[model samples]
Target: MQYRHLTAYALLSLSIGLSACSTAPLNLPAPHATETQSLLHLEDQFHLNNLATHFPDPLAITPEMKAFVKQHVPESLPEVGRLRYLTEALRNPRTFGISYHSGLTLTAAETFEQKHGNCISLTVLFIALAKEAKLNAWVNEVVENQDQELLADNRIAVYKHINAVVQLPNKQVVVDFSDLGDAYLRPQQRIPETRAAAQYYSNRGVDMLGENQLGLAYQYFKRALQLDTGTSYIWGNLGTLLNRMELYTEAEIAFREAYSLDNNDHTALGNLERLYLNSGKKSEAKQIRQVIVRRQLNNPYWHYGIAKQAFEEGKTEDALRSALRAIRLDNSEYRFYYFAAQIYRELGDRDNYHKFGIKAAMMRKAAQDAE
Candidate 1:
């Protein structure tokens, strides 16, 4: 099962829970008991107690995708000159989000034929074409002001709008959808100081860390901290690197800084506790865990992480219990069901195995449909 599919399963389960709840009391047990039991049954049937089982390894891009990218290569390079063309394309009244949405809905060939798309679609197109042209280009996930306004409706809805940035001989230029106006377009603005920039660098650091280039990744995270000192994410990244490097003292400091910035950053707290324990400071680790327990009373991810750790260490019963707690807190996270499914499969529970399998399959299908 794919991670996306697992996510879909979680979402479907949540949807069912939300829609099924009505003001009228069912002819069941107490209201709270009925709700709790119903959710638990749904979780068991779907194997939501185990998340790791549902996530398949990431797949390689298809040959067809590569061929499509090569065939419809853009004529212009993704440099400063391309900004003018992008602005001019945006001027057409029809070339708004709707147009871009259509382009993204279709394949690369279809989008190339249209020659116009929305900010996101255009950014994708630009990145694809730039890659084909062998130009240094990447899609920057920025939180725009428009995205901030949209968040009033949903906080978890990350404003993942894409924009293009080109590295010129002299300077870099930002080709953003929002910057496209009627009059002569202005020069690309200087890189601003924001939490988003911190996130951007932290993500780069993560990528580097994945490649095992810890030193480079640490530098990127440092740069991220310089850009936005208030961001807890950078501190988290820094702590992760320090831990990997076995710089226990520095790692603890970084984790503490992250916790100071956002007490809700469980990763930092967990890392700090781990570091304290490794350093033989068992009392300090216990104290930190106590603090974490007080703050993370209602946090599902904390429970999920603990469950995952237990599962990995061959403690099936403990893993199952922890996962169940996590699922009870937030049934919408697909990983919970995925993990539960794995545990059931291990215990030879065929009925539950199939139930969670179907749930995961359905969720994966939904995600593919959305894409």
Candidate 2:
């Protein structure tokens, strides 16, 4: 395997929507006076500007729908006097063709009322309800190729499931009606203090980056930070992007922010150290090295950090040793073998270099095999 060029330019051309909203359950602020006014304006403009689009044709309430309302709609309101209801009553089931691109068509609210919708419909319902309740929400689309066992057949399918976050008066809640099982009013679960939304964007950005779409990845990382500034991973990733762009000052600031958010983050610390060293800020680099030494006494990623720093500084032997230790602890990481091979090449150790090169190739092949 050759030294993979992780260029920032690759992420530049991918186009993604910036204004997409979240539908996951989370505490969100109600639309303020200004936001409400803006939303109303947009809604009016949507009707006036898009005259060709048709409104939902209201159908007569069927006996099943009426029964569903009676059984599912809560008789009493909550203490806050909020009357929570699905968008529309249940409808007759229709067999959708596999060609139906469900997600591209439905809104979150529509999915909620329909009671039995595809992934896209459910997502649409989640977003619609959040907006109707005047809460802030957004949408995240995850893309991957995996196999699913359906009943008796094992088939390869691409699934797009939509889950939402609702910002209640106090806390954020995740609403997933995809597995509601015949029940219409089941409550969703609350995500622990984890940065799910941030991680979602970060992971997307990483994928785009891998595909050589740097500009799009940068936008994703920026959006991730906007959603959860406390996420150290996004901050560190942003710093790495800045570094790739050779914007040293901006990269330093991002690394500092990441370190401030989580001092123990090895990625941030290592990147910061590398930045200081490259810029000839020896004193700062030394200080960072001291911090790394102190933390490495107990941390898992310490050797990985040390290996990366050594490789960057042209310390081939040290880099090779530290990278080998890291690989020993976690052989699944391709970075370990990749960097170790580079070090072996630098030291003119052709045999060892080819060995590590083969290891890196095997690791990548294994990942693709598992997928």
Best by TM-score: 1
Compare the candidates by lDDT and give the number of the best one: 1
lDDT of 1 by residue, 154-251 (tens): 21111233455666678655555443221012222333324434544555566567688765666666666666766554666676776777766555
Predicted candidate 2 versus true structure: per-residue lDDT over 1-371, tens digit per residue: 00000011111111111132323322112223342222212223113444332223111234443444455444464412222443222222332111122223332233334453444444444354334434455443322111111101111111323345555576544444344221112222333212444444555566656676666556667666666766555766766666776767666676666666655554566677778878998877666666555545333244666666667777877877777887887777665687789888888999989999998888777765653
TM-score of each model, in listed order: 0.41, 0.35
* Model 1 regions lying over 4 Å from their true place: 1-220, 237-256, 271-287, 294-298, 362-371
| Local lDDT at 139 for model 2 | 45
- TM value for model 2: 0.35
How high a TM-score does candidate 1 get?
Answer: 0.41
On a 0 to 100 scale, what is the lDDT of residue 122 in model 2? 44
Give the range of the ten consecutive residues with the poorest summed lDDT in model 1.
5-14
